[model samples]
Target: MISLEKDAGLWIVTIDRQDKANSLTPQMLEQLCEIAESAREAQALILTGAGRVFSAGADLEAARAGLATSPLWERLSGAIARLPGLTVAALNGTAAGGALGMVLACDLRLAVPEAKLFYPVMKLGFLPQPSDPVRLTALIGPARAKMILMAGQKIPVEEAQLWGLIDRLAPPDSLLAEARALCADTLGASPAHAAAIKAMIR
Candidate 1:
């Protein structure tokens, strides 16, 4: 399930199927894309999870049924990337498979100390969505991106931080608070101003 909370100019989106490690179904993925597309008026947006694991990627059944290679993953990530708001990935936990696409598109990524980062597309016999590798490489470099994308190695939060995959680490209890704090300035600024700064970096 995807839950979106709007607070004036700030929007927070959470994947809430905790019983399944937030594994995404096709409907859930579509919901996320719709939310991201509609959030252009938000001054800041935070994408996170409801439980310990941010997302285990696609639901097992869905992936096995051809959802793994769906273009919705690309559409969702692209919508987030095109947002005029400052987008933040508040990784409450590990992000695997297609789940990493949105995180890679975010303007900033802050994860809990225990979160692990990996994309097992290589092992799963599927190539990652189009922009994923390029954004990942832009953040952590080509070799490091290869370590995860090609080797399917899991990088703990500490190593992720060192390698630039994670911009900061927040304790579990304080994760959302830290995200809101990080968005404070963006929320206070005009949407145009925030978008301008974000675009300058792009």
Candidate 2:
């Protein structure tokens, strides 16, 4: 399930499938992709999940049915990356598998202190979304990216921060609040000014 909330220029998208550890279904992924693609009006976009695990990646049954290799994963991440606004991944908990694609695409990443990030595509015999490795390598470096994608290491929050994988670590209970606070300046800026700065940085 996906929950999208719009407050002025800020967009908050949440994955709301707690029972499934917030794993995404094809429909939910489509909703996310649509939201990302249509969020040109958003000055700041914060993506989060509703439970302890941000996402366990694709829904188990769906992944077994070929969802793991779907082009939707690449489409979703590409849409998020193209958003002309500040895009933040507010990781409430562990982020694994295909979920890492969107996280890597985000402009900034804020994670709970207890959160960990990993992608098991190698072990699962599936290649990651097309853009994931380039983005991940850009943030943390090719060697470190290899450690996670190739060696299958689960990167803890502190280690992640050290490697520049996550920009900040927030208290678990206040993760969203902190993520919102991080967007205050962007939220207050003119849409054109915000978009200009984002484009300049990229």
Candidate 3:
């Protein structure tokens, strides 16, 4: 469900479920958590998804089956979100539901031109994790975060960037490459200094 590659002191994590728009499965999330744990020693980390989407969010069928709230998913997501290193998200396509939460947790996000983001917990008749609102507000400000949560509206890629939701933009095909380049630039600096900077920010 996921692939990990290492190059130039960076770890690239990819969700490889194109047939399902790279939707998050419990198992996939577990693997991602493991990847993030292992990334602690790396200079940087980048996550993306296969095919046209970085992630479409949770598997709805799993939710209907009562598997979405499993403890494993919660633990795994927390591990990925708090990975102790420079973390970057390569938003390769539309990111919604829990996927938006994942992107919001990253230190930096490079979104593709085709990327769109939304928080539709209201529309789904479900509330997002309480911490999501905090992270969303930290990323895009309280006003934008409340608008997304309350209105259940989708924000286009450009608008999301303008709203401070994403740090940079890349072509769909080049999103991963851009992410790698950004990580490379990060790794080019002194690792110790970077770690110190990250610690200070945290």
Candidate 4:
């Protein structure tokens, strides 16, 4: 499930399936892609999760039912990455598996102090989607990326911040508020200049 809210210049997208650790289903991914496409006019966008868990990655049942595919994941990640303005991932809790791709796609990431991040593809006996490793490497470098994707390391928020996987850490209760403040600060930059910088960096 997904919920969208507009606050001033920011569009907030929340994954609301907390009962299942907010695991993403194929349908949910599709919906997110659509939302990302439509949110281009907003000055900034924030992707987060309701309750706690940001996302547990692909829903196992959907994968087992053959409803999940690398292409679908790519579409969702690509959509988020291509957003014209600033994009931020407010990691309210842990992020795992394919969910890492979504977080990486964002221009910036803020996580709660208790949040943890990992990609369990190796432990799950499958390779991460091709683009995932590439994105992770681009953000955190090959060695650390290997530690996460190949060694199946679970990184807590403090280490993640030190490694540049997350930009800031906030207390659980204030995570979203901090993310919104960051977004608001980013709005001080001209949209055109911000977009250009993001494009150049990518």
How many steric overlaps are in each model, in order? 0, 0, 0, 0
Superposition error at 145 for model 3 (Å): 0.8
Model 4 lDDT tens row, 1-202:
8999998778999999988999989889889888988877778999999887999988999866753455777777888888878899999999988888889989899998888999887777777777788888987899999899888899998998999999998888888888888787557777787788878876
Give the RMSD in angstroms, all C-alphas superposed, for model 3: 1.8
Instruction: Report model 2's TM-score to 2 decimal places.
Output: 0.98
- Which of 1 and 2 is ahead in lDDT? 1
lDDT per residue for candidate 3 within 105-200, as digits (tens), equals 788989888778987888877777656788888877888898899888889989988988889999887787788777775688777777788878
Worst 10 residues of 4 by lDDT: 63-72
Off by over 4 Å in 4: 188-190
RMSD of each: 0.7, 0.8, 1.8, 1.6
Candidate 3: regions farther than 4 A off: 70-74
Q: Candidate 1 at 68: error in angstroms?
A: 0.8
Residue pair clashes in candidate 2: none
Alpha carbon lDDT at 5, candidate 4 = 96
Candidate 4's C-alpha lDDT?
0.86
Model 1, position 52: C-alpha lDDT score = 96
Candidates, ranked, TM-score: 1, 2, 4, 3
Write model 1 residue lDDT over 1-202, tens digit each, in one string.
Answer: 7888999998999999999999999999999989999998889999999989999999999999988999999999999999988889999999999999999999899999889999999899999998999999998899999999999999999999999989999999999999999999988888888888988987
What TM-score would every model get versus the actual structure? 0.98, 0.98, 0.91, 0.93
Question: What ranges in model 2 sit over 4 Å off?
Answer: none
Tell me the whole-model lDDT of each prediction, alpha carbons only. Answer: 0.94, 0.93, 0.79, 0.86
